[model samples]
Target: MDRKEQPLVSIVIPAYNNENTIIATLESIRNQSYKNIEIIIIDDNSKDKTLQLVTEQQKKDNRIKIYHNSTNLGMIGNWNKCIQMSNGEFVKLVCADDLLDKNEIEKETGVMILNPSVNLVESDTRLIDINGKKTGSFKRYHKSGLVKGKKIARTSIIWNNFFGAPVNNLIRKSVLDKTGYFDEQFTYILDFDMWMKIACTGDVYIIHELLNSFRIRNDSNTGNLIGKDRETYVAEHQRLVDKYAGELQLNRFEYAFSIWFRKFRNAAIGIYLRVFAK
Candidate 1:
């Protein structure tokens, strides 16, 4: 495809200590069916070989550009840097350890072009264990086709729907310019908060096909949080509930009950994992 014929898509990968999985992740992007892509990798001062591996890969593919931080920028900080470095019409963030289907870029970009009103496009996600074996399916907003921004926001918040990880979504550059990127304050619920904000800003399109694999590893951030730092998870979940209470139109009782229910459920899950899972 000529440079002018195909629009550029920027895929930003934020990496820390992911030496073991970084190669496979990069390979997935390099093998994508979409030919016009710019792969930007931001290494957040990884103590391991993550940067070295990415640098070597960058030497081979002109499309892949690697940037290293002199000091650790943390997850949110590095993500913002990735956004700043991207120069594509469509942007996607693929974690260092996750995998994307070869055709994901092609399919998602086509969807975005065909539906001009949609600012965000998300697809069904599948789960893969540490060994890359298929584990299960990830939940997504059920309704497909063009969806209203306010309705998507309200239903996702009120009905307890799970918006899969950022890896499953493709976002427009214009929307990012309007929404102003992910809020850095959110620790666990950053993606969730961003999704809600994006949905409220404009239309969202959902694709029913599975286009990415979210790897489940014990060392991953969410895994570490859920395993030993569950209190942080519970706190962040509560924070989001509190922040969006008015948007969901929750009455006082409904707000209080939702908070209580979330606390109870999270506490129970933590206890169960601590006991029998041991």
Candidate 2:
């Protein structure tokens, strides 16, 4: 695609005290094969030098736009801020600690451009530790293609969030606008909830390739939620099942099974993360 013809993609990073990994994350986006992108970084009142480092990097790349919250909005609030501030054909919310492959945007954007019916495009993700070493992998589909939105929602409700994190997905801004903002009520499953909402509106395209690296740090929000507070995580997931059950046409048996299955799934994943993800 020509430089002028390529659609602008907004890469929004909701950063909070990610001083140790923010630069590397920014560099990954800066080096993307897709050039027509606007980097929106919203810092949630970090005590560290996250703002300063991003400011310096902004001088080097004019495409980067920085915003600092007056009061800390927390994770979900900061994410909603990034979505509101974005002005692009497609939006990607990449965590400050994660890294995207150079061709991540290019590939995901192409999929969306070719298929206007697709509201979201998600690819496989590589799991990396804080030190940036590959630990494991996260993938859902064995093949790449479009999946019905309702099908994904039903499957996800029964199983889990196979769509991975926000970094692994690209969403159409128009669809996102219709879907509305991320719900702040959700602490751990905010992205999962948003994905289900988007899937209800249109089809989802899945790419089997590992185009993003999700960094697993002990201090990250997910780490804290799943590691320190399993109760809240389970509660939020159960809430999703309840919220989507009727819309997805899940029967009482399916609904009951989903709730029970999630507990087992979470425990299995916790063990995997503890044993294999080391």
Candidate 3:
């Protein structure tokens, strides 16, 4: 596709000390089959060669824009800074360690343009290790086939699906204006909060095709927060339930019970994983 014809895809990558894997991640974006892209890389005070490597690559590629946060703004602040700089109509919140498949942008972007009801579109991902070896798979809001709004709205099936990973999809820039960004105070569950807010606004579609490689690391937030993570997630989930109390189709007491049920189920999964040595 020509640069003028391609949808302006804004990729906000929050960088910390990803010196080893950042290059391959950005390289994947550079080789994207769908071209026109604005990449805003926020280097959040990495003591390693993360920013240095980007600067080297920056000189070679004009599409790569690098920003250095003076002190550590943390990932959330770095993420917000990238969004502020993006001028694209579509946005993808990619982690510094994750990678986009060669055709993911074209595939996901096309769906959103054709499906006006879809405010966000996501697809399945092939899981990988830091060494770029295939691991398993990761997906959020996945279904056997294409899914849309009313189904997404009636229940929290999507949340129950992948446990809530934000970058599983490409979101419209306008939706951010309506739903707001990640909750700054959340040490975790920022994506969960964002998804909850988006779910209430419009249809969120999950593509059946695999579109990216989501790297799985032991120390990554999701992996680290296993058994103990539910408490924090539960707190955030309850806040969403309360925030959209009217839309849940249940009274206050009923809503609380539902939230409790979901949390208990998540905790059970964590316990099982722990016992099974997964």
Candidate 4:
């Protein structure tokens, strides 16, 4: 399809003190094969050179729209701000430190355009380290196709969030409106919460291809949570399971299983990150 004929996609980036990786993240978006996109970046009062760097990039690309928050709005708050500022048929929340494959947007958009019933489309993710070295890959489904929203939600409740990160997914703005924004009550599992909500609304399309890279840095939020405040991270996961238990009609056995499964999963992930991801 001609770039002009394509629907506009909004790539909303919520950046804090990400001066190191912000430029790379922006470049990844700018290099996408999908030309019809608006790069909306919200700087959440970064204490570093994030704002200045983004401003410099903005001058080169007219499609880049930048906003600076007077005061620091925590991670989730900044994410919501980006969503509010976006005006596109589809929305993608890319973190300041992540990178995308050149054709990521083009392929994901094609899936959404072809499957109107799908409110979300997610692909496999390549995992990279702080130095941008390939560490591993995250591939959930064995095959790529449409999955029932309710089934996905239920599975999440039982087995924990397997939807990967925001970079791995593309969401319809209309569905986000219906599902609402990220829950502020969550710190570590905010994306997981939002994914479950979006999945409850409509079917989710899964693409088996790896279209994005999730960077793992020791100073990153998830990294810090898993390293220093692991107890809190586990608590947040439990909190979400509790919040959705009743709505999903989860039984006592299922609830109990979720709690156990999360602990096991956390342990396994920790081991993987330590042994292979390092």
Best by TM-score: 2
Candidate 3 lDDT for residue 108: 83
Runs in model 4 deviating more than 4 A are: 275-278
Could you tell me the lDDT of residue 2 within candidate 4? 94
Q: For residues 1-278, what per-residue lDDT tens digits would candidate 2 score against the true structure?
A: 88789999999999999899999999999999999999999999999999999999999999999999999998889999999999999999999999999999999999999999999999999999878889888996544699988888898888777777999989999997687999877878999999999999989999999899998765677676766677788888889988988899999888888888877877776665665443
Model 4 worst lDDT window (10 residues):
269-278
TM-score of each: 0.91, 0.97, 0.86, 0.96
lDDT of 3 by residue, 1-278 (tens): 56898779898889999998889889988898878888889999999999999999998789999989889998678777877888898998888888888888888888878877777787888777667777667665546434655455445632353423555778888888977787786666667656666766777777776678877665677656655567777776666666656665657566767687777777775664454322
Show the colliding residue pairs in model 2: none
Higher-ranked by lDDT: 1 or 4:
4
The global Cα lDDT (0 to 1) of model 2 is 0.89
Ranking by lDDT: 2, 4, 1, 3
lDDT of 4 at 240: 91
Error of 4 at 69 (Å): 0.7
Q: Against the correct fold, how does model 1 do in TM-score?
A: 0.91
lDDT tens digits, residue span 151-262, model 4: 8788877975768799998999998768899999998889999999898888898899888999976667766777557778779888998988887899999998998887
Once superposed on the true structure, which residue ranges of model 3 sit more than 4 Å away at CA? 139-150, 157-163, 227-229, 251-278
Least well predicted 10-residue stretch by lDDT in candidate 1: 269-278
Per-candidate Cα lDDT values, in order, are 0.81, 0.89, 0.75, 0.89
Preferred candidate (TM-score higher): 1 or 4: 4
Model 1: per-residue lDDT, tens digit, 1-278? 56568889999999999999999999999999998999999999999999889889988899999899999998899888998899999999999889999999998899888988888888888878777877677766778877776676766665554566889888888888888887877876688888888887878888888899988765577666666677787677667777777776767776666566666656664554444331
